[model samples]
Structures are given as structure tokens and as C-alpha cells.
Target: MQVSTILLRMPNWLGDCVMTSCAIQKLRVTYPDARFILVGSKACEIYKADSLTCIIDESKTYPKTQRWHFKKQLVGLGVIAKIKAYILYSLKFWQRNRIYATYLLAKSIGKADLSFSFNNSFFGALFLCFTGSKIRVGFAKNARSALLTHALKLQDSHSMHQVQKYEFLIQDFIEPGLFAHILPLKLPQSTQSLLIDDKQHKHIGINPGAAFGSAKCWQKEYFIAVIEAFLDQGHYVYLFGTDSNLSWQITQGLRHMSITQQKNFINLTNKTNLTQLVDSIAALHLFITNDSGPMHIAAASSTPMISIFGPTDTSETCPWNEKIAKHYFCSHRESISKQSLVVESNIAILCKHLSCAPCKKRTCPLVHHNCMKEITPQEVLLIADSMLVS
Candidate 1:
């Protein structure tokens, strides 16, 4: 039988979009020549376009108010006319492809079994179902499962990591099994060219931000402490983030540290594109990151890493490659709320004393975030020390 079309309803965020590349990989293996279409938010185009033939940018169609634009005064009739024209043009394009079912990548978005109705956001699944695809695939989160001809049980917090979990959903369509083999991401040529020379440096990559919000981030002081230790050991540190202010703060803190050697911290925030960023991460000997997108990227690239969990469960989102990732969960399996994720693990020298930990606050709901504050830099340094020795 010929596999004709595949439409994938991608996640809204950049990180999830990147992680879902595993699904695309499985699709390629099963339907090598089939038309692969991706329907996703506009921000996702840069990451998903390389993997799919067509893209439907939801952001362009559903425009959100811009913060900068809000302060500006509404211009004259001429400006209003241009805005209306643009809106009209975008609507036309959106409606042209609005039929939904004719979408090429309709593999897993249908099936009432994975209905989004319960979640009240099953529009993606509903679109796939109405698109009239024969083989639709998606996670059944609600009563909408009835619409899905091919639906997989949606994995929860205690389930396998996101990559593995999603692979299970798509693997049901093809032969053999999903996640039977490791998923590998090919580094872009641009990223290949910008590889850092890590021959001598005990290169450590630090990502100090999480998209989930500040609640997920480890303490800044702890990060600085870890960097200081790396320098003490004559190692080079690479700091990455999208925020310029954050990059500056990290670099400034490192420069001010009492290390004897010259500053070895390289801030690559806003400097590299997604591909280069991945390549840079892949080049690192060891990477320490919060539970974030690049963490998934590192896992996909097979880079050895230590992911600090907070505001999220590791079981559900930990890096897929077990051999390469060492996750440190702060909470027990049962009480594994976001707070439990950030409490420092009691791993020997990295241990701390605090019965009142894992507070799990975005801004310290109590106005004091002690859980993250108490997790000293020495704890993380100990882990990095082990990685360097290994």
C-alpha cells in the first residue's frame, strides 16, 4: 500500500517543536517519500521547515498584540488602511488552506480516541479528522479519541521522556517498534563550520534559563559558583541564553570571580541560530542545563549532560538517551511536583540540609524562594567534577 500524505500538528513552543523532530524522524523512516506537512505556530517555522515540505503558520493568521506596538499611537487613515490590507491578505492565505483535512501531514491529528475536546483545545485533532485523511495519528487526551482512527494513549508526568513518549505514538503506524533505535539529528552545515575548539578546555556549557519561567531556573549564585569551580580547575565555560541581559550578567559575574586564569566564559546568547546553537552544544564535553529545549537538543545530539529539574517532572521530559543524560530529581516519585524538581539532590558532597525544600514557585509564591536559594553551587560543581574525570 502506498503512504500518501502526513500532516503533523506541532507543539506551540520552540522547544517542544524541536523535541518533536523525533516524530518526523520516525515518519521519514516509515514513509520515506510521502509528502510531509507541518502545521504549527509561526515561530516554529525556522525549526520545523527543514523537516517538512509544507508549513501552516498559525501565528501569522492569529496575530497577537505586540508590546512595543501597544505604546505607539494609532496612525492616520493611511496606516489603518495598510493594516487592514495586510490583515485581509493574511486571512485569504489562511482560508485557502483552512480546509484542514486536505493537509498533507494528517497522520496523527484525528481519531476521537485522542480527542482534544476534554482539554478544550482539540482543534488540531479536529482539523486532522475533518481533513479526511485515512491514516491519522495523535495522542488521545479526551473524548475526542472517537474521531481518531489511530490514537495512542497520551503519556503523563510519570511516563517516559517526551521524545520517547512521542516516538511511541508515531511508531504504531509503521513496522517494528518506535524508540527501538536512538533518534539522531543531523547538525546543519553552518553549525558544523562554527564548531568551538574544545581540545584543551574542560568545556562546560551552562544554560541558566527555562521557558517555564523563573520557578524552573536554578539559583544564579549557584551557577556562578559552578563557573568559578570550572575556572579553578583550569576549565573553560560556555554560557548560553536568548536574553542579552542574562548573558551580560553571567559574563560579568564570571569576570568578577576570584579565579587566577583569564576569563574563559564565552557568552553565545543571540549570537547563533538554532542550528549553530545545536552544533555548539554538541561540541561540548559536558552540558548542564535547566529543563529546557536545548537540553532536548543536546540529548538528540547525544551530548553527555546533567539536567537540573524544577517546575517539571524529569520522567516526562528528561533527555531521551539514557546513556548520555543523568537527571537529578529533587522530589520523590509520588510528590514530584515542579517544586520537587528544583530541590537539590542529596548526592554526597552535593548534599544540603533543608527539610522545607522544593517550594516550587515562579516568584517564590511566598516571596522567598529558599529551595533554589539553598541548592549551593558546590553541589552542581561536584557533578561537573565527576563528568570531567569521566
Candidate 2:
């Protein structure tokens, strides 16, 4: 198969984008001699460019909006004209590949030799189809499956982690004999500096918040309890976040806190890029967090971790690495706290089944979030103690 340009549409969200790294690696292994160019969001632009061979930044390649007013006037035209106008706009924008978007399309198909979109969205698949690549591949569930030359089905089982899901998507294209547990990351020197720089008294890394929403966040007190346990064990806590506002909230009660060895390292969030985040996570001996991006990174780094779960099914997206020594769940039933998957984990898990279980609601439909409230700090301590002893 002779191919010049290979275009891949990256997942839009942070966690999905990170997970897609697995697919990237598989593609690399499959097409060792081919040029791989990925189309990704602005937020992931730096990561894709840094990690992959060639990246067609979506924000750069796709038109966000037309020039000043002339573009708007075209949109007002009839449906056929409007469609023609947008196609022309896409072709033109894609051609100049210019920062601005309106260029030209010489033939029915655009520039890419082969293009694959990771997402199954109609629009995402449609846009790729519009480009007229020789081969288009994505999940079979893709809304625009008819427009594609190749589509694969993703099974509905919880047997594999989410990262593996992305890897499986590209299995047909590559030699399916090879497989990897997690995607690899190449950290830059600047990111490495953040990992090694340690003047603070304690070096405990804390992921106090989870982006998956309240359903995944364990009780805040559980975090505090774990912090105290780590302090007793002689480690300081550093909180990680991709948002500045959340970082400050994590650092709020640092000085007044009691856990003897605990110190606030909440300032590290959002300031550094993805590479630094991975490096900093690598430096930690252990990471205790809710089901979130940092948790996945920590797990990929093979850091001993205790991840809490609530609303989501761990079988579907839990940390697959053996380094995950323990997992804590509020209750696996919908009868418990619906609003919050308030749960905790540290080292080893003692009891998993709760009377009122995985309610799966943001707030308890019954108005009482008993599943999480019932779990005490002492229980987590017991598990931690057992973990250290073992």
C-alpha cells in the first residue's frame, strides 16, 4: 500500500486524548515507514506534536469561523449554495493550510492519503469523509459509518480498560498479535525538572479532585485521612490539578492541618503542561485519587495507587496495572448515594459491599448520601495499616 499522508482524528477530551496515545503507538508500530499525522484539539496540540511524527492541529486545520463579514454573507445564501460555500471554505482553508481557513480543493478528494477519526460522531466522520481519503477507519458505531471504507466494532464488555479500547480500534489495520497494557510517554527535560525539584519538606502527591464529576470524587475527609496517614509514614502531599481555581481550593487549609507529616503542594496544578504532569506523577511513591486523568497517568507510570470508584463501573475503565494494590467502592448498587460516588482507597481494600450501594445518581434520589457517609476515616486507616504491614 503506497501512502504519503496518514491523518488521524484524535479524541477531543483530555482523558480520551491521553488514552488515544495507545492507538498512536499501535499505528506507529503498524506503519513504521509511513508518515503519521494526527488531527487533535488545541488543548492536546502540544502533546500530539511533542509525541507523534506529524500533527495536523484541528484548531489550525479546520475553520473556526470565516473571515470578517464575507463568510457570514455566504451562510445567508440558499442550502445548496451554503453547502457549496462551506465545502469551498473547507477546501480553501485546508489548502493554504493557512492559519485562516478559506483555501481551495483541486479534486473531489482533498490532500490526505488515508484518514481515521477516533471518535464515532457523525460530524467527525463526515468531515473526514469530506476530505476523501483513500481509507477511513473508526468504530463501527460511528454515525457516519456508511461514509467510511472501514469500520470496526467495539464490544460492550468490561474486560478491558478504556486505553485498551482505543488500541483495539486500530487492531485490524495493524498486526493484531502485538498488544500493550498502557500507552508510553516521553517526558521533556523541562517536565523532568518539575519532577526532580523538591525543596519542600514533604513530597506526597494528592489528587484531591476528580474531573469525572462528584460521582467519582471520594469524600474530602478521606483525602484528609490519607494525607494524615502518609504524613505519619513521613511523606508530604502535593495536590495535582489542570485548573488553577481547583488548585487553590486544595491548598486552602494547608497550614492549619493536623496530619503530622502533611504539607500542601497544591500549587502544581494547571501551571505545567501534560509532560510535566506525567513526570511529576512519576516522582510519587504512591497516588491516591478518584477516577480521573491523573489517576490514569499515575497508574500508567506504575505508581502504587489506591483509586476510589462510585458511579462508574470499574470493570469498564478501572486502572488495569497491577500496581493498583487496592480499589474502594461506595456500593455497587443504585440503591445508595445517587449524587456522589463518595468512596476512599489506600493500599488495600477491606470491605467493598455497602448496604445502600452504587446509587449512580449525582445526589441521592432519596436525599441521603448514606453510602459514602457510612465509610469512616478509621476504616481507610485500617486498610493503610494493613497495606504497610503486608
Candidate 3:
């Protein structure tokens, strides 16, 4: 099969995009010479180092798809909100993504040999259809199965992690049993990881913001308590904030600290690009974060990390674990980790097991986000202490 080009619409979020690396890695193996045209938001910056990848910056590949954007519109409106949510679920209203997909044929891309999407939206399926590729692939939800040449059913992957789901899609649909491996996410070869040379205190990062929705975020008080502990123990605290408001909130919580102690709290929010962010995170002694983008990046860098979980299920989206990763292995990634000592990853899940919990909703539909709130700072700190000492 002379596969010259692959048009891949990447997943919207940083973490979702990162999760697809294993599949892309396998695809690269199946068609080493195929040109990978990856399209996404600024989140696509992570793929910049791949020499064969053609990066396309298109944020509206699906618009208003953020959970917080819909949470406010559908929370209490009853039947009207449910109707709206249903419509928004497939993101069918946004024709911009479809239009962009259609225009790709006119550009240097011409016609792709293979077109696929990590996004499972109805509009996402339609986008692939507009590309006019010989082979289009996606999940067979939103009644768009008729449009795809290869459509994988949703139920078959209900229990699969995002990484495995993607890898399976490639192996089953594109190339059957060609390769049986799920390699850990790894950034492209670069100038090596970067960090300041401060050996006096071990560096630990705290990311309090969750871009998905408030339901996915732990309590601010808990984050403050953990940060205070890190400072008191003579460790440098790296505070990561995506927005200025979240950065301010973290600062307000730490106002009680002395100026000298506060110096240890370094804020790297709204600064640095994707590459810098990855390098900075790779240097950390340990990373503590909500189930957010940076969490995935930390996992890729092989940094020991603690990922806190709430409404989201740990089984699907937990950070990379050396123990769990080897179980889901592939050829190229099998030969590594020869070191005698390794600092692996851990999870601190604090869901009350409420029926409504793990709803995977952007915000809590019940108005009481106890799942995330119930996660105590003490519990997270205990894990942090153990990771630091080891």
C-alpha cells in the first residue's frame, strides 16, 4: 500500500492529543513514509519536533466544545438544557470544521490516502467525509457510521483507556495485528530537558487549575495546604496556572507566607510555550496535578507524579505508571527502563462512589461537587511525602 499522506484531526485538549501518541507511533510504523498532517489548537505544539508532521493550527476544528461552556447553558434549564446538550454533544452546528476539512484538498495536502479523527463528534465524522479520502475512519457514534469507510463501534471500547482505544483502532481497522504494543507517550528528541540548577531544595509542581470544569478540580484550600507543606519542608514549589485568575487565586492562598518562604513558590503560569512547559516539567522531582494537560506531559517526561482524580474515572485517564505501562507495551518502547531505580507514578482518587460520580461531565450536574471536594489535602500530602522521601 503506497500510503503517501495521512490527514489526522487531533483531539482538542492537550491530554487527549497526548493520549493519541501511541496510535500515531504505531501508524508511523505501519506506514513509515506516510506524511502525517496533524491539525489542532496550540495544543498541537507538542508535535512540533516530529520532522514529518505538518502542523495545522485550527482551534475551531470543533467550537464551543468545552465542558464549562456547556455546563452553564444546560445545568438547570431542565428539558430545554437537555435538548441543547444533545445538540451540542455532536457539535453539529459548527460548520467551520467541516469547511476547513473540505478546503484541505485545495491546499498542498491535495487528497489524503487516509483521513481520521480522534474526536468522536458528529461534526468530527462529517469533517472526515468532506476530506474525500479513499479511507475515512472514526468511531461509529452520532449516526455517522455510514460516512466512514472504517467505523469502530463505541461499546467495544467502553472499558478501554484513551491510549488503548486509539492503538486498537489502528491495529484492528487499519492494520490487523500488525503490531501489538501500546508504548508510553514520549516527546520527540530535543535539546534535552531544562530546569534551573537549584540543588538546595527538591522541586515539586502544583497545578490547581482544571480546564475541563470545576467538577474535575480539587478544592483550593486543599491545594494551599499542600503548597504550604512543600514550602515548610524546604522544597521549591512550582505553581502552574493556565489563566491569570487561577494564578491569582493560588497567590492569594499563599499570602500568609513570609517573603523568604514565598520566593520558593515560583509561578510559571501564562508563560512558556509547549516545549518549554514539557522541559520544565521534566525537571521536577515530583509533580502533583489535577487530571489536566500538564499531568499528561509530566507522565511523558518520565517524572514521578501524583495525579488526583475526582468525577473522572482513574481507569481511563490516570497518569502513566511504569507498572501499568509495561503491561501495555509495544516493540520500540520495550527495551528501555534498564535503570535499577525508577520513580514511578501514583494516583489519589477521592470519589465517594456516588452513582452520579464519574459522570465525566464538565461540571457536576447535581450542583454538589463532592467527588472532587472530598479529596483532602492531607491525603494528597501523605502521598507527596512518600514520593519525596523515596
TM-score per model over all chains: 0.71, 0.69, 0.80
Higher lDDT: candidate 1 or 2? Answer: 1
Error of 3 at 149 (Å): 1.2
Comparing 1 with 3 on lDDT, the higher-scoring candidate is 3
Tens digits of lDDT, candidate 2, 1-390:
666667777776655666666677676667777776655554355354354543434434444333534467775599898888778766665444332231222122365766787765765566566677778877777467797788777665344556667777667667656553334432222345264356554355677676646655666666666665666566556777765665554456444565343333345776667667777777776666666777666655655566666555554455544332122221232222222232233232222434444455565555555455565667655544554443
Model 1 Cα lDDT, one tens digit per residue, 119-159: 12466666667667666666676555676676667545343
Candidate 2: Cα lDDT at 12: 66
> Worst lDDT window (10 residues) for model 1?
111-120
Model 3, residue 108: C-alpha shift (Å): 4.8
lDDT of 2: 0.57
* Off by more than 4 A, model 3: 57-108, 173-178, 189-194, 325-352
